[model samples]
Each structure stands twice: as C-alpha cells, then as structure tokens.
Target: MSAIVSHRLHLPGTSPVHRVPAEVKIVCAVVAVFAVVATPREMFWPFAVYAAGVIVAWRSARIGLRWIAPRLLIELPFVVLAILLPFAAGEPRTTVLGLSLSTTGLYAAWGIIAKGTIGVAISLTVAATTSIRELPGGLSRLHVPAMIVVIVVLMLRYVDVIADEAARMRLARISRGDDPRTIRQIGATARGVGNLFLRSYERGERVHLAMLSRGFTGVITEYGAEPATPRQWVLGIVPAVAAICVCACALVVR
Candidate 1:
C-alpha cells in the first residue's frame, strides 16, 4: 500500500537506507524523539539545530520534502497550543518583542514549540520512509508482544476495507442529492457512520470465525528483518550527532 493513504512511501533511489532493517527505522525515530524531548527546556537554538539534524537525516535517507511533509498537519495543533503556553501561564514578566509575555513562560513556550515540532517532523520523516509491512516484523523482532502485532495487523488490513465501504455508501447518498452540509444532515451522517460501524463489526466477527476455521494462530510470525546495514548507521548518525551537539550547545548556553 502507498504511504499517506495514497502517496508512495518509498523514495525511488538506491540509498543504503532503503534496505535498512525495519527495526532500525523504529529505533531511530524513537531515539530521535527522545533526543528532542531531552533537550533543556529553556533554549530555542538547540531545537532549531535539532530540526536541521532531522532534515539532514531525511536528505541522507533519500526521502524528499514532498515525501515527508504531508504529515506536518498533524503537528499544527500541538504547535499552536505550544505557542500559546507563554500567554497562558499568567506569571508577571518582562515583555519580549513588544508583546506583554512572561519570561519563563515564553521560554517554556519556546521549549515546547521547538521540541514538539522537531519531534513531530522527525517522527513523520521516519513514517514517510519506512514500509508499513516492515513495521510488524520490526515490532515482532523487538520483543513486542505478538498479540499487539496481531491486533495491529488486523486493524490495518481491515480499516481500509471498512473505509471504502463507508465511502461507497456516502457516494450513494450524494448521488441521491443528500446535502450533507446542513445541521439537518448531521443525523443522517451519524446514522451512516453507525451503519458502517455495525457492518464492520459483523465483518470482523465473520473474519475471526473464518480464521479460527483455518486454524489461525493468535500470533502471526514475521518473515523476519534483515540486519540494519552501515548505510542506516550513517543516515542515523548525522542526525543523532547533530541533535546531541545542539543539545549540548543549548545546555552550555543555558
């Protein structure tokens, strides 16, 4: 399946990172997230540096801005909230840049904005590049409980089917000139959703029964992951080192 619903997840290149083990991508994302979070909360420069680091890694991994940027919308709410944090704190403080804002609160807001944005971008980049199929195997290899993987696998496989069914039903309504933009249409839409949910529930039961009849195991085995090659290491190290250096600089500056 394509990434971002229909977008191609894999970049077209022979970069070594394209062949890296799935587990490594997961680890890199997690470690990078931690790096962003672990930086001191009082500085902004480190976070900018952190963003640069992730971008560098993305470039090295052969992932383009277009490939990775679609997911930035996910971070918009968080960033907006983070930007408001300083004003919300209500501590008596000095104004910065002609705005009556608290000092520590401003710093706090900056901390969240910078770190949170970096974290989301890094996470999205990993998601953009990594294959969905590899995720199950990576999780299984990393000692994640097999049941968890099983549930994830089931949900991913079925959710799209359920969604298409919902869309088809919606199209049927639209063809009948069911105007959905009014408050009066809300009930109809709710009913449509409820109907879809019921259908999905029944389908899930039938699938489970079929699986049982076929002697399905609770845990599906991963075909297994190839080793994380050196290319992956290089791709990882650029960002990791950049993030660490930026954090160090922030710590020193603070």
Candidate 2:
C-alpha cells in the first residue's frame, strides 16, 4: 500500500514538511483550503498570496513546480468548465474582444479556477509529504468518523489495484487487436468499463468475506506514528495561520 501510494504521489523527502505529523499536515491543509475558499473571489490578491504560500510549502518540502505541474492536469476538466461559464452563463454580460460574456460568470469562473487550483495544489502537497500508511492514523487523530476513515483507507488501497486491473484489461484488448483510440472501439470501451465494474465488485465481495472470516470489524486500528508535539504542530500550522490571516484581511478590505 505504501509502495503504491508513494510511487503515485509521495515524493519521499527528508524536508521539515515531510517530518511533520500527518494529522498536523492534514489539519493545516484543510484550514488553508477553507481560508482560500472563504475569501471573496473578487479579491484576487488574496489568491495570489495563497498561491505564494503554496510555493513556500513546496520549497519547504523540496518539491518543484516541475513535479507538481503534471499532477495539476487532473483538474483540467474543471478548467474547461470554468472556460465555458462566461459564455454559457446568464445575462448581465460584457463584451471582450467581440465575445459577449456574463459579468457574473466571469467572477464565477475566476473563483472556480483560483480556488480550485489552490485547493488541488494544497492537496497534492499533503499527498506528496504524507504516506498512505500515515493517513488512517492522521484522520483518526483528527477524530474523523471510524467508518469514513476505513472507507478512505480502503479506497486508497484499492485505487492502485483497480488501476492495475484496468491496465491489464487494456493490454489484453490491445493484444486482441482492439484499437481503443478509434471511434468504432467506443462500444468495446464501454463494454470494457462494464466488465471492469463487475470484476471490481466481485473482488470487493471476496475481500469482504475473507475479512469477515478473519474476524474483521468495521474499525481500523489507529496509525502507529506518535502524536505531534506542540512545537511540531505550531511549525506545521504556520501556512494555515497565514492563509487565515490573508482571508481575514481580504474580507476586511473587501
């Protein structure tokens, strides 16, 4: 599980950011995202400040823009939605370079893009620093519901498994001369998806039964990492504190 998550997201760093407890990092990331989301979208400078804070975090974690940029592609669909908003949104429109767009939609798009980008960046930072093994303990320490923690842990554990299954299935299809890139293969692709779902469902059932046989309970054991010291918490929380301050100032100035 750790190997799977580490290969996909964790950067395996020795920086102070990596040294901070997972729970502390989780709390800080959540607080920072809340601060960004709470700030008025019209206040653009605050987002910039929030972005700067993320950059500082990256530096502290010894992660580079090059490393983070590729991962940001996961948010491209939201970016597309943001792009469409100004055109498809209701009236109260303005003309830009011969294109009429909604005034409200413009702000909405900015809000989505700005807030969403910062949120993803913050999340990736946390994922890069924190291992999958640390997550259950972190959420447990944060008093997250046991069921929710278990669900999250299970989801993370199986994501790589499901992904590998999909890859193998795809390879099998390709070997059988099914060209997935062509339009005619759309039907095959859809069938492949349906088959994948059924396979995953069966696997889940088998795993659940095995767990029950082994005296499985709904609760997950807490993570083995020691609790964060006061100093560690303070050090880890500085970015969130700064983000909150920025948000407060943005509200005041707005």
- Predicted model with the maximum TM-score: 2
Ten residues in a row with the worst lDDT in model 1? 1-10
Query: Candidate 2 lDDT, tens digit per residue, 1-254?
Result: 55886888889989999999999999999999999999999999999988888898899899988989999899999999999999999989999999999999999999999999999999999999998888888898899999999899889888889999999999999999888999999999999999999999999999899888988898776646898999999888988999999999999999
Q: Best by lDDT, which number?
A: 2
* RMSD of candidate 2 to true structure, Å: 1.6
lDDT of 1 by residue, 32-112 (tens): 687778888866667667776777767777777775777566677877887787777776788778888877777787777
* TM of each candidate vs. truth: 0.79, 0.94
Mark the regions of model 1 whose C-alpha exceeds 4 Å error after superposition: 1-13, 93-99, 102-105, 229-238, 241-245
TM-score of candidate 1 versus the correct structure, residues matched by position: 0.79
Clashing pairs in 1: none
